[model samples]
Target: MLLAPKLLRSSPSPSALIAMGALVMIELTSACNVVRIGERKISRKLQRKGLDANTALLGEANVHYWDSGDSPETAGAVPVVLVHGFGASAMWQWHEQVGPLAAERRVIVPDLLWFGESWSRKRDFSIDHQVETLVALLDHLGLQRAHFVGISYGGIVVHELAAMHPDRVAKLAIMDSPGRVYTEADHAALLARFEVEDFADVLVPTEPEDIETLMALGYHKPPRAPRWVHRQVLEGMYGEFRDEKAALLARLLEQLDELDERPGKVTQETLLIWGEHDPVFPVEIGERLAAELPEGTRLRVVEGASHAPNLEHGALVAKWLVEFL
Candidate 1:
């Protein structure tokens, strides 16, 4: 089930009108509908790369993904699954990566439940539920094992997936996610850094300013776009499932607190990728996590990149993934 563009019928709020005024004052009329246009272009690019937008009814959710077609070029190639983070969908987040990675291996990128087309009637928002949905996706696709790459929130999901079902994961790559190493202090600091009582206000953005703050934190060099662009992004991407996503975050925090009572280290070889100046989960967290994992676990720090190195330096991240996996 490919996601259709949302039809926003409501009138623009006071802040939105002010943003429009700024856009008009700047005379950037040609940049209207930037988000929608960008989505269409990304869809075209994925199609050109031999990836078809697809969906599978896996358990309770409909998992929407981009799959490199089963052609002769990639018939026997090992599958690689890319899971996106909280804010954006799979296509927007993994656009730069799919082309390069799919050239050598069959790449599958799925939108997590409640983020894109994937959703469920069940109220369970635990990490275990997310892992189960992903495992069901693999089973539905007839894939016994595949290399998994996850970013931020997606990284936590993949980590749990790898730990819970070792035989089903060939290798693991976690980017900017501290996994079970995330501490109570880290959570409190995150709330302080954002100056918000609830972390959901930072991750599940409600306004253009929220988006700007998220981008400033996530990117080393955040894109300089008009306020209207941020408004469009807030509406197009982060507007839906607000409460459900907040619940997911709450569950994640609870899981982090209870990590010690759960399973220990995973057996599979893991690759830990972190940004040099990640304020969300700093390099120290990555280093600590690397030590706690299996003996051969490797950590790679992308210099000058903040929370999202994969977005900041896509080619370099893709190269590392190819070498490590």
Candidate 2:
């Protein structure tokens, strides 16, 4: 069990120690199942709007997702898959755009491994396995090719899919992700920006305060909410599978070194959307990606937005996606 850092203090009263012990017990118990006030509302709203809960029994896991639109094989509409970053789930990340996009295209939003209701019994948490899992899901849905929209970590996975199986992917859009290979220099720069030695220190949060810190880092204007709301969100979204997620993080670090050491030229026409004030991967990264990608790739910047332009500027991002895809 990971211990929260102890505050250095003078000798505490017996009552205070007892209260602390009780709080620890509550936290551990709630880690398994805590009803998040805000998340529940948003989830229900998304479901009411059109997103339906569905499950796919893949090889190693039973993946749960909120899917919209008919399968690609059966429908004539263009297929578009939205892959979310490291956080809660597809429900949380793409809730704003799902309905709007589903109207015109066949939109599929999936929860990545160890996220939402998705989990793997096999110990393989490498990026290659993740790529395989997604491919399997696409196969299950009878999709041979589709446009992909990814945010942050999800962007990396879609970029990999395009590189490894270019014929299987049509168009690609990446937001707030370093699609290219990251180097030792990039690692140092991130650590310096976050004032943390490891990326996990910033990406993974154990406490409510840590979650808020992550939000502050990711968003230019973090939402103001009550303390209890933040705590509930953390316990509900991140408390489960803590160990597995940490293991996955370790595997991802190794894969970044091996799989994306030096990305080859991506031939597919790409649309890169970035927030002007993105604190995580700055606009410069997007500029670099545009230059590195083949000619005809476009970069669209959203002013006043942060890491997640989709959430910050949903209508504009949706317009771009519809036009680009």
Clashes of 2: 0
Give the per-residue lDDT of model 1 (tens digit) for 5-42.
22124566777666666756555544457877888999
Residue-level lDDT of model 2, residues 144-263, one tens digit each, is 988889999899889888888787788999898887656667767878988887677667788778888777876778887667766877777887777777877778777767755545
Score candidate 2 by TM-score against the native: 0.84
Question: How many residue pairs clash in each candidate at the backbone level?
Answer: 0, 0
TM-score of each: 0.89, 0.84
Point to the candidate with the largest lDDT: 1
Residue 165 C-alpha lDDT in model 1: 92
Overall lDDT per candidate, in order of appearance: 0.85, 0.79
lDDT score, candidate 2: 0.79
- The TM-score of candidate 1 is 0.89
